[model samples]
Target: MPRVVVDVMPKPEILDPQGKAVLGALPRLGFSGVADVRQGKRFELEIEGELTEQVLGEVRQMAETLLSNPVIEDFTVSVETPVAPVPGAGA
Candidate 1:
C-alpha cells in the first residue's frame, strides 16, 4: 500500500483570520513571546493496489482540482510505501 500525505496551507501574502484569532488568544492566555502563527491542513490516505505512473498523475491532478485551492492556498504531496525487511540469517 502507498500512503499519501497532503499538506495544504494559505499563501504567505494572504491574511489568515483563523490563525490571527488563535494568536491573539494565545497572548491573552498567559502565553507570551509568540510571534507569528500559521495554520494548515493535513490529510493522510492509504492507497491500495499498484501505484502506477498514471495513478500518480491522477492523484496530482485530483489534489490540484478538489483537495486544495490554487488561488489563496498552496499544497504539497508526499508518497510513501512500505519497504520489505532485509533477509538475513539470525544467530
Candidate 2:
C-alpha cells in the first residue's frame, strides 16, 4: 500500500487569524522563542495496491477541488510506500 500526505497552508496574502492567535498565545503557554506560527492542515491517505499516473492526477484534482481552497490556500502532495505486512502475522 501507498500513502499520500497532503499539506495545505493558507496563502501569505490571506488573513490568518487562527495562526495569529496561536502565535500570541504561545508565549503565555510557555513557548517562548517562537517568533511566529502558521496554521496548516495535513492529511494522510492510504492508497490501496499500485498507484498509477491516473491516480496521481485524481489526487491532485481532489486536492484542488475539495481538500484545499484555491483562493486562499495552497497545497502540496507527497507519496510514501507503506511497509509490507509480516507474513502470517494476522493468521
Candidate 3:
C-alpha cells in the first residue's frame, strides 16, 4: 500500500503560542542550541493499492479543503513508497 502524508503548519506571519511555549521550556529542560520552534501537524493516510496521479490530486484537494486552513496555514502532500517487511527476526 502507498501512504499519503499531509503536513500542515501555521503561516510564518502567524503567532504560534504552542511553539513558543515549547521553545521556552527547552532551555529549562537543559536542551540548548535551538533558536525557535514552529508547531505543525502530520497526517498519514494508508491507501489501498498503487498510487495514481488522480489519487494524488484528490489528496491535494482533501488537504486544501479539510486538512489545512488556507488563510493562516499552509500544507504539503507527499506519497510514501511502501516499505517491504524485512525477513522475520523473531523466532
The residue-level lDDT of candidate 2 at 68 comes to 97
> What Cα-based lDDT does every candidate model obtain?
0.83, 0.88, 0.92
lDDT (10s digit) by residue, model 3, range 1-91? 7899999999999999999999999999999999999999999998876799998999999999999999999999987777786798552
Ranking by lDDT: 3, 2, 1
> How many clashes does the backbone of model 1 have?
0
- Model 2, CA-based lDDT: 0.88
Candidate achieving higher TM-score, 1 or 3 = 3
TM-score of each: 0.78, 0.84, 0.91
- Candidate 1, clashing residue pairs? none
The digit string of per-residue lDDT tens for model 1 on 1-91 reads: 7777788899999899988999999968899988989887887867778777887787778778988899998988888765664689352
Candidate 3 segments whose C-alpha is farther than 4 A from its true place:
88-91
Measured over all alpha carbons after superposition, the RMSD of each candidate to the real structure, in angstroms, is: 5.4, 3.8, 2.6
Which has the greatest TM-score? 3
